[model samples]
Target: MTRAPATRELRAEPVGSLSVWQGAALYVGAVLGTGVIALPALACRAAGPASLLAWLGLVLLSVPLAATFAALGARYPDGGGVSTYVRHAFGARAAAVVGWCFYFAVPAGAPAAGTFAGAYVATALGGGRRTVLGTAAVLLILVAVANGFGLRVSGRAQLALAVLLVTLLLTAVVTALPHARLRNLHPFAPHGWSAIGSAAMLLVWSFAGWEAITHLAADFRRPARDLPRATAMAVTVVGVLYLAVAATGVLVLGPADGTSDAPLAELLALGVGGTVHVPAAAAALLLTLGTMNAYFAGAARLGAALGRDGALPAWLDRGGGVGEVPRRSLAVVTGLSGLALAATAVTGVGPQPLVLLTTGSFVTVYALGTAAALRLLPRGGLPHRCAFLALVAVAALLVMTGWYLLWPLVITASALGYLRRRQRRDPGRGVITS
Candidate 1:
């Protein structure tokens, strides 16, 4: 077996400026994103009260997944993130597939996330589909504008939003506990026990960010030591919050939990008792802004990097350099996301399919990343063990993902086709368009 270079073999790597606390904050921001806006309700609908099991399962699963990525990051420490690790473990062909999956996933997924927040706004303002689509459209535009203009939201501001999101969610769960009834637990698996697997697949969106922070691993002051600590802290916080919210939705809202698109807002209304719409919508939108903005910037930059690396068309490669604004890449992402949103609105298919599609892509990335970890990390070590477990888990997730996996499969083919064509043209090193 041609194994990757073990961690101990690499020496004299440069350290970075981020502390444990800062790294943890970044992880929180990355993983605890806009999915929380509506996932509990959606998952509840999928599996009735039993969706809590899926939530808990995903939470528990995140630890090994997070650890696997952290171990990979501490060793390779590249901005290429999963693509870099895949390259080391497999080859450039496989790496390109990972890059395409990730880059294209943002466009496919962003609309769903925006629609999640949009549902909250619609719930608050009473505009129904019009309001929801309008809000989602505005969000997509704002994210593009922010990234295109080089407008940066400070880390402290993002941290504040994360804190506020957690606190608000906890408040809803705690205050609403008084209304929770044991009766709601009855008929737990209304859709059958098999529904639990479906819920687990949908909930993958909630836990998809473990590899995101890997890109910044080199920026951590001590990647080996601090990466795991940050991952652990983020896992604990995100798990507790997700569990509390899902459990509270099941118990407090009962049948309503399976219906409402804006379940968090509903929870706030039930908990706070009267007139929580403004505050709830405001909080949700602010948090969504922070989450989507960061995602847009990151995905745009990744698209640029992929383009520059010949994994994508070179038209996007212009802004891959440090401090350069990836306007072309950003435009493509924004345009694609907008089209996705428009299609969903016209077809009235809602965000569930979008969520599944995005989750499908992430699961593919996770599978490859974990498989890479098994080869990259030292043999007979704890990290390797975690990676093995994570690989098994992700394989199961990819299965649960079912038909949605088709999307990533198509992306994989496109990536390979692009690489093959580019190789034919250059017959050597790849060239750029602009």
Candidate 2:
């Protein structure tokens, strides 16, 4: 008698909640936040016109990396995205460390987003410390309130804001093209290729959140097949948008002209020749608000995942019964973020420090995740070889980029401390990988 074909095991029960579009929106909103608006100027400062090339390099590197995560999420569908994947491949303690590192990274992002929002508001209102801090506080509270309601509510708001911001950004880019000068292209690599690589470290951070959606894999209607596509689509759209805006910035304002505090706004002011500060400022305000909203939603989910995995206190894992909010987790996220914002404001350190710290942590996670994928590949299959090669490439980029390897030891030590505490508290508990 012929034997029946072997059945594949399902790792986790499907939550069966979020629609495809909702999933897509979450991916897009998470990736496009404050970084999209801020990076063009920052990259311009670092690499001049050659930053566009860096953006392109990041897009190429990120897509496969995102696909690798999506594949892991589809197979696992666990609470913590990268944490879950690492646990499955490496073991529970390893996963806990990953969770802790990600948890640490998530809160720092708050100050980055808040500061970006505050800066835009400062420009709009003619600048003041109190005004900037107050505006940031108000924006954070608004996003926190919305998140405390439900993911569906926050996701819808994200969709709307993302659409509006993209529309305005595209309009500005297209409108300014006619006024672009050719002289800007004369000295394309003013800072040399090394600057492009360094800036790529920062540029990759802007594109980092595409994998954030993987944390909610259980919510996807058909995660096994659709998650990868959604992730690829989100990364593609955001990458194209970033390139378009960066190209426009370089073309219109030239790399040198747009390197100031409010680069995009400055570019619009110059391009429009003193006739459009109001509209440009208004767009900047909206873009900043959108960024804050996206980060708030994405970061909270990450924290909640960490809590659910027992990397944090269990109280944060309690969802507000059906249709209600994750009030406890929301509080933790908001409180930590608020503390970071206050520290940033008092120390007068701009977003760069936090950006570097968080980005470093994230790249560590990315390198670890890719390494985990290589280990998890089957013994003999064409797909396995392909994945192994991809992971190798990812490893090279992580090394060549060289930011995470430089400063991740501190972050790793902190994560190890957290992991030890968790393990000591419950030695018998098998760390849930999914």
Candidate 3:
């Protein structure tokens, strides 16, 4: 077997200490957020009962993707997650491109998610769009504060919220299951398998954040041993929860009724009592908030890691006191997220469009990361062959789900330009490595 270089020998510094459970919580919290709550209704509308097929397809694709990430994390337990993995497997230029893509996706996703959370809160509070905007602002500020303190503090809150969200969702599912009408499943493929595939593309976004935990692999207690287990557990739990909630939404509301905006909330209101709607709305808000916090933590760290590597502004590398927060990077994240919120509010583009715009960029990152896994796999063996084939499949799926690849390409070109400028300033200075 070909052994990879030790993290310490490679001069990779550990930023914080995070146990397996905490890391798992971060992963689950990020992966299960607002998308899980919102997408089932849309998926049902898009594919009818056949949306279940989309869910299953996503699960199958996601498991191997998650496992590939876990294996990469085990081999390269360093910060910057996918970027570092890509750099180790490929080279600095490719890693730089991946870093930019991942970084952009974070802010791109923030506004839509924040808006969704805000909308849920507004409904719960009997307010309007203004209230939703206010809620979004408040959520951004809260997440920034929590993350600025450190991952440990933010991660604990995230874990608690994840548990609460899962419990509430599961309870709602169970209650609604008894009320399921058999007629709801008729005309399973209302549109066609093509539509199901399209819906599956959208649903896959809900599963995107599972790999975020790989960014903090060095922080794990025993990353090589625990990383895979934590990643698998997180993805499996989130997948099961997603399917359960989707089923509950279909069961109680029926295909026609459940196709509306807030299907889960509608189901809870019907299955339990009208009184449950308020709490369900509140749960949705909290779930989105948890996701925002989780992403904030991961994105800031990625920025700091990029800064450390001289791909971004160098000030971001400065660490916080106890929580391992890069204070400068946190500021950047807050500012960018705030800007995104403002832009979305002004333009009136909802979550779907925002998510669609960023999905291509995210898929590109996944493709590159998976390709890196293939390259880094133990050389000259069946393991390498299998890894290469899996990576190829992932790459093909990314291309098949074409939304907008140009955004990622533009961001990468900009990063490359910045890198070139820095290199010219100091010709002999070597690029930072994991």
Candidate 4:
């Protein structure tokens, strides 16, 4: 089936194959990634113990933001995700912009995510840059191959990854708590209160994935019945684990929390009282795999949908329908990810910048996605209320994102340009809005 997959017209999945637990696992896998391994330390550097407040604040914001996407996903149940919502609310041109932002951001972010996990592997195995690059290449390829088989395989793999990573995180938190010194809380605002904003910007990387699962919402056995349930489960798990880990890192390691190479590894070692790099590396691998798997699946499907809707090339529309694997679009995503990794390796750019770039794009997506929800959802309903709240929060995030928004802006122009060019070529198939 991987060869061009199946050809079918656009339709809501006849019946989704994913169960509630599986959907929840996919959500967890998408949102809980390498950020847990390094972001707490990075945020602590940006704002000291005050970073905990930043983490908590994001977890709180997640309620409405996640709800907004879940509501849209449940209502639409299409692979186009926010792009589909935007198409319904605004028009084709705007939906294309949303699609391009998300579809392209996956590749830009893949190198960063892969490198994070690879760094852990290198630290554990003593291979350094080569190990990091090799590990990243392998992960990208594995995730691509898995998704090429369709969600049946990738979703289950994500479930397994979620189970493992969640257990490791909880264990690290529980065991490390005894060693946490209350003194760590003393210098909470050491970087000054303004630094909390910086920390929140960095934490946006950790929070970006909440919208990703919307692309796969159609795969749920009963999207309307199961999407919100899965979202709630994922939000609770992600919030608790993130808060627990952030607090544990700050309390146990104090100033060192801001500088640790692998904060989660150090925390686990302190609790377990021995060398834990190997298992820590394993957990990192699972985390990266889960993240890449989810994104590859969602992005591939979204690409096909964009293609099917004439936002992207018709050649890519082969797998836009339900029960079809977007192998062609998957190939495009994988190729772009490899090229992104290569560019970073050659140019000596760091993961941090790539992360900010990714976050910027995702924030732009959330801005438009929430706006689309505000228009598409029933007025005066719970979903509409959540969308309103989410739109407000996303606006704040846009300002915080600063110059990092440049990438998505360029992508926006590119999307619009591509559409205009297509319109000039085929006036019959063009519209300013869908």
Best by TM-score: 4
Across 1-434, the per-residue lDDT of candidate 1 in tens digits comes to 12343344222144555567766766776677776777888888889998989988888889888988887877766556788787777777788899889888988888788777877788778888899889989988987886686423333455667777778888888888898999999988989999999999988988888887775565566777888898888899888888888888888889998888777878888889899888788767875776676577667767776777678877897865544567898899899989988888888887888889999999999999999888888889988999999899899998898899999999999988887898898878653211
Error of 1 at 422 (Å): 0.3
Q: After TM-score superposition, what is the CA distance of residue 115 in candidate 3 from its true location, in Å?
A: 1.2
Runs in model 1 lying further than 4 Å from the true structure: 1-22, 148-154, 219-226, 318-327, 430-434
Candidate 3 local lDDT, residue 102: 83
Model 4, TM vs. native: 0.96
Q: Work out the TM-score per prediction.
A: 0.91, 0.88, 0.91, 0.96
Per-residue error at 161 for model 4, in Å? Answer: 1.2
Separate clash counts for every candidate: 0, 0, 0, 4
Which lDDT tens digits does candidate 4 get at residues 1-434?
00121122224654777888988998888888878987888899889999998999899999999999998888888889998888877777788999999999999999999999998999999889989999999999999999998888777878888999999999999999999999989877998999998899999999888888888888888888799999999999999999999999999999999899699999999999788999999999999998888889899999998888888898898976667799999999999999999998899788888989999999999999999888778889998999999899889989998999999999999999998899899989874343
Overall lDDT per candidate, in order of appearance = 0.79, 0.68, 0.75, 0.89
Query: How big is the positional error of residue 332 in model 4, measured in Å on the Cα after superposition?
Result: 0.5
Candidate 3's displacement at residue 70, Å, is: 1.4
